[model samples]
Target: MVGRQITWISSWKPQRRTTTSNGRTPRYSHWVRYNTFYGLVFTTTLATLLLMADLIEWRATGYLFVLANRFPGTVALIVQLLAAFFGLIHVAVVCRLINYALRLRLRKASVTLDVLRTWVDMSIPRIDWDLPLRFFFPVLLVVFLSLVPAALWAGSITPFIDRTTTTGMLLLPSYEDVSLIREYPMEIGTSGPSLRTQKGFFTYSVGVQHVGNLLSSAASASSSTTGKRLVHPKLDNTQFSYIGRSYGVGAPAGLTDMSISSNSQVAGYIYQEEGYLCNVTCIYNRTSAFRLRGPVAEWIYEASGNLPDSVDSGEMSAYIGHTGDAIVAIGVAHSERSPRRYLALAAGPSYAFLNSTQCALDFTPHLFNVTVDIANLNISVVPANPIPDFNPQRNLTRTVMRQFELLSNDLTNLYVSLLGDALNASIAAYNMSRPPNAGRDPVSVSEEAATLAGLTNSITAMADDMLAAYASAQLMVGKTFTQKRDVQVYLYGLQFGQRVYIYAIFVFNLLVLGAVAGEAVRTRGWRELGRFNYLDPRDLVIAASRGGEGVAWAADGLARRHSKKKKGAGEKRKSMKHVWLLSDPDEGNGSLSIRMKGDGEGHVGIVVRSPLFPPSPDPEKGERGGGGGGGFEDGGDAVDADKRAAQREWDRRRRQKQRVGLFGSM
Candidate 1:
């Protein structure tokens, strides 16, 4: 009974006037009429907010770098100001609408029939007629506001953001930045530096080497690379192009093996012992192993007497640039398990040192370099604020150990503050868009910003803490293992992967929200156009003009019920037509008859069959019976066997009948 009553109540449309049990008259005879203005305003406001939010997010993520190499922070500020101004207008409009609604309610006479009708026309309850809109609106809004933006960013903006961010990191000076001096180009075939003349001297090259993870199966694909397809050739393999040289010679040849050198340049030989693990040696032109036999120089021996591998993961390593030749050297017993992968430097003599020295350097406009110790959990230096009196030899251990807690706290606080400021700005804009004293009270802009900022900071802190915890645990684990086992190296890989996953999930959630929000806004437009649902007036009009059959089954339930039945009928008809058109009539047409006779159910039966496979009459039976039609057989086992043999013989004859041409008698 309740279902029937609900169905009856739900059958009323906006265009049809109806009254409730309380004698309340419907407005516009449809649900769309009642909620049109509310829907329109709400949708417009929501869309504006979404756009503003997107702008802020885009700016924050430095998405504008794809257009020009402008300062991202400046661009973000401009976007924020513009969004703020637009948000102000939005708030003003909402305020006006709220005022108008209040005034209208106050002026209307209470309980009067005319007033009641007016109220019904203007009430939010009008949305009830288009109940599906209500059901889907919130879902759409959530998706649009959150997910769609993320998707758009990912598809169009996020790549740019990532590109710029990554570029900033790679552009970090791998070698000392010295003033450039113009010099005449060296002769193409002339040698600049010879290792032979400098017999008693040793040189080391200090540079950053980037190792990448590539699947072993992709080695062939590596051969076909043009190499020049990226912003930085050394950083991205896709941009690499071969120089005129052998696989182990010349400019491109020597650089092919290394992704990024300490000087942010490519090295020729890249060696990886495992997935996402690599060892790179930077070279300029010559392809021969720098340490190998050369007329100018001789490498007595390597620190480990082997190619770079896990054993070299922690040793302080350097590339020696002597004259024109370069050689990479590593310390014999440097700690690879140290959290800080120290830079190798040589001040004087052949002896080189890998130092965990911290320097104040903004590696990029947005990124900073931080140096920390793995053994003591100390912050050697924050690049954002490097100490002036920094000395690696005498003060590194003392300074780092002494100021560890202070430096860590300061860095953590700074990150939190920056994130908080951004969040606060967004919340402020949100507040400016809400009507004064309307609905639930808007959160204080400062508080909301603070809350968001705290969360972001907490997340970053958690990551940092995890790294710290893992490093300490790894140090202990390394000591416990006597066979040069370093768990810290593997832990870093896992930690990096987890970080990527978290970022990916966040982006996914935002994309989902944006999509939902976009749909909600689109639905509002349909509501305004008297098309509350996809199957409403628009469908009927389109179908009518397009010359399709129309039915009275437009009422929701009736429409669905009849539509389902029609679909079933259509399917059944399609199946019947296919059967009639396709099945073959030939093989075993007499088999069923034989089986029936053998079973002693001997009544003559008619079986419907495909036109393509109509039964064939037995020629022998027809001739014997003298009747034009029926073929018959006895029901005994001997008869059955005879019939089966006859059927097999018929099959053999049929196969023979379809031959293309008679073979010449030979």
Candidate 2:
């Protein structure tokens, strides 16, 4: 039985041989040739889709992350959920495409195998059962690996988004409205030397005598028996300047003249001799310039040596005497000017009266009395320039003169009234000293003298009080000073939230890079088709044929079952086997032939035949049977031998070609 089997296998041939008119062995088709070409397109498209999906997910997640910081907690949660849902959809679609590609590869392998069998009598390779598992597991592993970076990116970016998007939010617990105070100390007046200063000490060289004195002197002369006697015998035209004199006191040196010291005083005496009377006025016009100390000094200089414009007008006790006695006076002054300094009369009736020409020219015998009354009494001080429309010099002169007249008259009357008893006593004493008949009262001379003495003491006391008041008002004219201090104000500014958002963007970009890298690795390295080996159909066929007669028969039966349906009449015929005959044309009269035995319908066959030497022609029949001149014929040992030789040559060439194709030129 074994020997018969061996012989049968050795004699086995294809049912039909197909060949071109010029016979040559056909090249074997490469396994996976079509699959590789198409597979590359499929994989590229899938990878692109996956990359796009990842990019979209990355962008969507980034947007959601920003919203998570800006919106309220519930709203942010909803946005995050929507993002995750969409992202999952994208991932699912990509995974599905990957799965489809894997399945397509398996199907293509089966299809290719079948197609290849029609051209070559060979088995097609089958994909390994575990291929799908291998592909899926790696994809899963890549996804898992991607998650590490994705999660890290997400974690890193969340805080950054929160910080950037929610920055400056009023709801933050640490948010605060803060105030800052700033203080600036300012000095607003000239500090080095006062405009009224000359060398150093306060200059009292300029002064103004009371106008009341001049008026009083004039009155006294007018009431006296002496007709226009000189009131001040010591005065002379040479020793004084008149009010109209160019060089006189208070007269401007030039049209644009500026006085070194504004402080000035005027005093004069009236000389009445006979019918003509002369006025001799003296002016102390120079200031005792000095450095003013303290905070108000600079202010004083800045204000042009005058009190601040805001100074209040009222009566105040001020030190005016050379002995520094506090006397009541009316004027304007600021508390901030100099607290420790004596109150200097800024402007008042006293100051005007002292500076007036009438007072300067007055020569009343009771001048001291009138002045004492004015000093002890409260009076309104007319400002130096009280009204802008009126001339200050003229108004001041008129006002001071009027006040002086009234005062002088009133004091004279008071003195006259007070001296009534004394005068009466004097008259009586004079009568007694004279003839008895002279009408005289019996009054004591001693009593009369006592009354006169008391009156004199009272007058002296009044004079002293008036002098003090006048002195104080003259001290505070024309000086300016002020002090400055700084105050702080509160303001608001922006804080923390802006910084957090910047970091989130950075993290999202990192995640995008990771996703691209993972996809590249999966497509180019892990799921690469070349990495796995598939069973070739040709190898399968050879294995099946060598297994046994039953295996070979079964394979043949299977191929027959899958054959194409019968063709139309005009269709070209089909064959299951391709054969080739190889020979050296130079060999003398050699011939080759091939044949196979099989059922006429739906069967496969193959044959080959060759002859080494040409046979001679039969002279009687005139025919050649086993040489180049003869064609293929059945039932001949010589034809069988020729078929065997051609088959062997074809097999040798096919093996050589396959070896060369597989391992390069060998």
Candidate 3:
């Protein structure tokens, strides 16, 4: 009841008049609106800042980048503050827009004084729950947009949590730097080593294999991390792209198996990788049992005494390359075997053995594509090439194991040839001396193997993948001979997806802010927006004071007394309208009021007459006493006097409150 007092001009503090820069208040401010420009400025500023934050990614090299990295939490707080500021700007834009709308509605329509009231002052959290359905649409949207700043804060800050992937070029150990790998020691057994591949065979600066990783990939093509022969963490959170042929060169120094290779240190994620690894295809041949024995480059004698190298076999092995081929070689082997599904013939059980129809290899260099999980150290590798006989899909194998390839034309190096030859010899030796393929797949041994192989060969599951990734990790961990190359090092920062989401949110914010600002200028309402202050209840009270006698039935608690009948939906509520907030003008200087249809021109409203009631005599002017408000239901000579008194009390209370400066206490 205290805040509900009706207002009159008598209570409002008279605004002191002031001259405008144009020397006079213009119609639509002399055909130009100034506050419209102010609104534009606010929106533009918000847009620029939002865009700036988005563009500054991991690659931002200076102060901002460092600040975001070193004080991530602090930076995040600052971002939140900025978002709050953005909200403030948006609020101002919305307020201005509502005023312009009110002005338009005032010019074109007439209505009951429902007091559109701060767009129902809808921005408040709990003051009025009925706001949305309580007003006209689209116009309400301006008020609804008060939520924009908050929405932007939630939707835009996506990169803050993506700390594992700030991508930028860095100087790290590359393929050319291979000192990182554990060096193989001097070995003399069946280890791979051609005549030209002994100690000090090739001059390598950092101590061993020079080139590592990929072969013949296009310069612009992203590196493939799907090779079956790459060894790395299963849950990698980092990534990098190689620069040129900077990977290491040569085969692994007798390293065997994936366990000996790859690490899970905080180094980085190896998402995609390219390199060369060794693969072998074995074709099974059936044969009769007979005694045979020998090594590569020799003949195995059979039980019959005379037999060709291919036909005679308990076990046998042979090599195809002579000294002319210094780095690469081909070989074959034979072993007695028991088929998985054995068959018995009428001529006695026939035995199967890999004989003359076979070629021998522990492994050979072939192009390989790899995918690695840098975090968990799980590595997946696949041979990109197809085989002549083995059907991978036809095998019905669901599990994909690490696989490698045989030598391809892209590899022109002979430095690590010793390892290849060793692998070949080891396989041959296993064939001729070993009884059958039933034993675990054979692996070549080398004591010089300082590091275990990182990538695994699925066929034998016996040795490491001495391909590209092994060399890379070796070099990176060793941190030696690292020439600064523009390696695309992925660390911690925003990712592609986060950036996209932010972009979309920014666009939405821009469009809404821009429309509100643009429309204000277009309609020329900005000039008069400052004249109205709808947020203050004082303005509404003054408007109520001006309501004509037709609305007197609701005055002095009359509506409350008759409140039993409730109206809802289209049946309830109506429109009302504003008084000029004249703070900018002096007391003597007059101000304008955009009166509503229900308002009367004079301070005291004229009475309304309805046929339902006999008209009462007007209050005796000379007997007009201190205002006491409306008379009771009893019809009497005092009825008009009571009404005049009630109206006067309402006016006096409103006038008292109005005298206070609206910009200050109000």
Candidate 4:
């Protein structure tokens, strides 16, 4: 039976093939003729431009470069590790896609070869062995170019982000409890002026009058002294009296009351100590007859009151007789024997009358009785005449009279000389008891009085000075004090290596993120397989066809069988029918045989020559003539060949259709 045959001729021409000077097309395309140079240049330029842009952005931000420069070794190590990790993933993806593409191309070539063998029974004449290199190198170049940004990002920018973020987090405002110490000296003393003396005197007089009158007179006296007094008095006899106590006698009647003058200013008194003094005076408003008890001598002597003329209750007058001639009187009289004694005595009644008085005055009467032996003169005066029944008044007047006599002797030369020695001794003792340059001890009233007593021959000056000094000291001792307070201060703001570690971590994380992003962009969301799919199918097919022996044989058969051939010369070229080749290699050399099938069978068969396999032995050649063209003639063999070819063709057609459908969907 005759089988129908269908021939397939390639409509696609190989553009890379070129004819040589021998007028024959070369088996393989020239390597340099492919337009890979432009692709290589374009890809390289694109990569370089992208790298430059990345560098520009890095320079504009400046942080990455700065950090890298600051810690180059550290940054370089970290960047290398990061690049390695990303490069591994990139290489794995690229390799996987390239491998998959290679397998797919091989499978496609296998299917095409199966189709040609089953339908046409032919193979190509030659294979382009360098095809795989052309396809693979371009893919490798593109993949390599895509990885540049990822590597750059990993090396730069990441560390800066980490460092800045960590530093910010660590830099916060905080506080701590603290204590502080400080030292200083405080001056504790009186705030105002230095203390001074307030001096005055008092007097009392008793006459032949009612005791009630005396009490009333005392009650009428002023509470404090009113007149000015001396600050520092000299020890002299003409200015002060220290001789005897005297009383008025042989006066008018009706003076029946005892008068008292407390704190009266005494005139003609010499002050021999510092601070204030009080002298008492009693006035005889009415005369009363009085008598002297001892040493009665009638003599007129000037009596000067310590008060001013305007405030004095009475004028200076002469006293008649005096008694109680104490030894102090002889000393004063001896010291007053100078030529100017009378002149001083004449004018001493009015001195320092009223300079101005401070209202805040304190009055204290300090009385001291001091006695010292003098080698000047011996006084043995016995009272010549004495009045027995004339008792003196024992009131304020009597006390003033006695004090006046004592103070008078205090100013004597002998007393002054002795008092000076005593004051020098006291001062020397006080100085020896204290450190040099130390301040004086606070002087109390009693202390001041003692100090004055050591210097004065009378107790009044001692008492006054003691009272004033004591009051002043009290005001000075506790003038001010010290206390403690709290204060705020700043310590440290940041410490330790916290800043270094925080910045390092922050920059590291940021760099990693940048690396991921760059990688994603470069690989188009990590779709490496999809990216590799952009390789040309023709290139892949040629590579597959070149690499496999089965595909190479199929290509060779197709080239040889499909080429046009010239007929013998001089004979009219008979009309030639297009021939198709098919084969069944499973039948060994017999499988290489072909048979014709009728039109009713819907297939054609042709025997093709193969350099790889020997021709099959023909049954018709044995019947007709042996050792001739070996062609198959049995209907059974034809039937078997046709059946096998039809089965393989069907499978090839199905596979081709599936491949076409898949391509269409894509």
- Scored by TM-score, the top model is 3
Q: Write the per-residue lDDT of candidate 2 for residues 450-546, one digit (tens) a residue.
A: 3333322222222222222122112222122111111111111112122223243234433443544565466442222221111333433332233
lDDT string, candidate 4, 1-666, tens digits: 011111111221334233445432232233422222222333233334434534333222234445555686896577577555544444334343334333233222222222222221111112222222323234445555445534543533234321110010001100111010111111234121222323211111111111222222212211122242222311111122112110111010001000111111110111111112333221211121111122223433333322221121322333332322211120111111111111001111111110111001112322222110012111111122332221122112122222222332232231122222332354344333344334544543343333332222222333222232222222222112111111111111111122333343334334434554565466443231111121334433432322223223233333333232222333444342222223212211211222121122111122221222112232334421111112212212345465345435533542342321111111
Q: Candidate 1 or 4, higher TM-score?
A: 4
Q: Estimate the TM-score for candidate 1.
A: 0.18
Instruction: For each candidate, give its TM-score against the true structure.
Output: 0.18, 0.17, 0.46, 0.19
Runs of candidate 1 exceeding 4 Å displacement: 1-63, 66-78, 85-93, 108-666
lDDT of 3 by residue, 205-311 (tens): 11122212111121111212332222222101223222222122212211111221232212233322333233333333234332222223322111211112222
Candidate 2 lDDT (Cα, 0 to 1): 0.24
Question: Which 10-residue span in candidate 1 carries the lowest summed lDDT?
Answer: 202-211
Off by over 4 Å in 4: 1-74, 94-149, 152-552, 559-666
lDDT of 1 at 227: 34
Task: Say which prediction, candidate 1 or candidate 3, comes out ahead on lDDT.
Answer: 3
Q: Is 1 or 4 the stronger prediction by lDDT?
A: 4
Instruction: Pick out the ten consecutive residues of candidate 3 with the lowest summed lDDT.
Output: 340-349
**CA RMSD (A), model 1:** 32.9
- The Cα local distance difference test for each model comes to 0.24, 0.24, 0.32, 0.26
- TM-score, model 3 to reference: 0.46
